[model samples]
Target chain A: DAGITQSPRYKITETGRQVTLMCHQTWSHSYMFWYRQDLGHGLRLIYYSAAADITDKGEVPDGYVVSRSKTENFPLTLESATRSQTSVYFCASSKGVPETGTRGYEQYFGPGTRLTVT
Target chain B: AQSVSQHNHHVILSEAASLELGCNYSYGGTVNLFWYVQYPGQHLQLLLKYFSGDPLVKGIKGFEAEFIKSKFSFNLRKPSVQWSDTAEYFCAVNPYGGSQGNLIFGKGTKLSVKP
Candidate 1:
């Protein structure tokens, strides 16, 4: 309730279909990240947002799109899903304190979204 | 690009047995290291972190990690592990200056402690 949460904990969609995974954080953290967990790959970042309307690409951002229209919501969209994209997706949030001159903030993760693309 | 490497992909130990999980990162400069645990059917939670000061960092449930800068390693250890300690453990690194707080995670090690 107070921490980060993801909608549609489990999802199944056909190939070439559009799907969105929603992430919401009540903490109002300035930073939000979307990562995909797959066998042998661990958790690879797909996209991250510094603040509302400020998003950046991560390690594996190809097939995935993310938008943070509001500080509380950062949704990841799959333009046209593929079987390779079937994996557990995780959303993480961290509060940045620029005064520290270093990015030492701890990140909190939400219950992952298990997406199955067929 | 920064990356993390977890040596052990899967580990098995009996109850009360000692536990150790090796983690190494490929980053030249300052970094913030972290250990996260994901219990069965649960979200990933921070087990411990190393920002500065003492290299020996203690975490929840008798878990501890020692950051060895020279070796570019941060290995997690526990004196006595229990059956409840069976879970997936991940080691991550966030490079200090240019990373923008994005973490580079390892492949993770799954620990199974027999009761």
Candidate 2:
């Protein structure tokens, strides 16, 4: 497809193991985000990158790491994964926030990766 | 910190029945509202959004939402829903003037329509 994509649609990992989720977008969007969806928490932002080299923490960032070395790729790594980290992960991309006199832009989401920590 | 609340966790309705999903946010500043839908085994897609101006915004698939600034609510509605409308709906908000384009999402409402 021409939109965003995530690798390893489904994954199973053991506790204390390191797992990485990859996200790629062909649109050259300036902003990329990582979110985890749980039963009660619809989708919580874990991290977000404004550009290739600028990244920041989101609502829940502990035990999670993200890097945006290139505009088309944003990878999220969970170091020492725990059972509580098992959830569906979604990646989204946007063309950056609108400036003072511009309209807002919609975000495009990837097909989500289902991660299970055993 | 900002948060979104979805009034209904699960809703069941027959075909052609009216539909309404309530959403509220806790942000005090200017914000942009959005409604997203996820079908079975599909990614989330934007249904509607309200940034400014008109409070009532129309989205794809015959969906619409009204943004009430005073109540801090954006409710999704449809006069008559089809079985195809059965899916999970989520409400999200993006605070205006925020550095990044991050969004705070509601806990989603699962709608099941009987054919």
Candidate 3:
């Protein structure tokens, strides 16, 4: 309730269909991240946002789009889902401190969104 | 690009057994390292982190890790592990002089502590 949360914990969608995974954090952290957890790959970052309206690509941002219209919400959109996109998606938030630099914060993660692209 | 490597993919041990998970990174200069634990059907939680100052960092749940600059390693250790400690452990790194939000995570080590 007080931490980060992801909507639609489990999703089943067909190929070529659009789906959005919502992430909300009550902490109002400045930084938010979206990652996909796959077997043998661990957790790979797809996108990250520094603040509202500021987003950047991560290691595997292909076929994935993210928007941060508000500080508390960072939603990831898949215009057309594919089989490769079927994985456990995770949303995390971090509160950055100015003195310690941005990397100084610890990330808190949500339960996760298990998406099955059939 | 910075990257993290976890040597063990799966490890099995009994209760009260000593545990050590190896983690290495391929980044030069200063770095911020972290160890995160993900229990079964749960989100990832921070175990310990190494930023600056001391190389030996102690974290939650009787866990500790040592950051060796010379070896470019940050290995997690626990003197005595319990069945509850069975989970996936990930090592991540954020190399300095770049975007702080960019964190390179390891493949992760799955620990199975038998009771």
Please provide, for model 2 over A41-93, each residue's C-alpha lDDT reduced to its tens digit, 9 standing for 90 to 100. Answer: 89999999999999999888999999999999999999999999999999999
Q: Against the true structure, what is every candidate's RMSD?
A: 1.4, 1.2, 1.7
Give the Å shift of residue B29 in candidate 2. Answer: 1.9
Regions more than 4 Å wrong, model 2: A98-100
Ranking by lDDT: 2, 1, 3
lDDT of 2 by residue, B1-115 (tens): 7789999999999999999999999988888899999998888999999988999999998999999999999999999999999999999998878876788899999999999
Which 10 residues in a row give candidate 2 chain B its minimum summed lDDT? Answer: B94-103
Q: Taking the candidates one at a time, how many backbone clashes does each contain?
A: 0, 0, 0
True contacts kept of 2: 0.60
What are the lDDT scores of the predictions, listed in order? Answer: 0.93, 0.93, 0.91
What does the lDDT read for residue A69 in candidate 1? 87
The collision pairs in model 2 are none
Candidate 3, B1-115: lDDT as tens digits? 6789999999999999999999999978778889999999988999999888899999999999999999999999999999999999999987766664666899999999999
Please write out the lDDT profile of model 1 over residues B12-115, one tens digit for every residue.
99999999999999989888899999998889999999988999999999999999999999999999999999999999998876545688999999999999
On a 0 to 100 scale, what is the lDDT of residue B16 in model 1? 93
Model 1, A118: alpha-carbon shift in Å?
A: 1.2
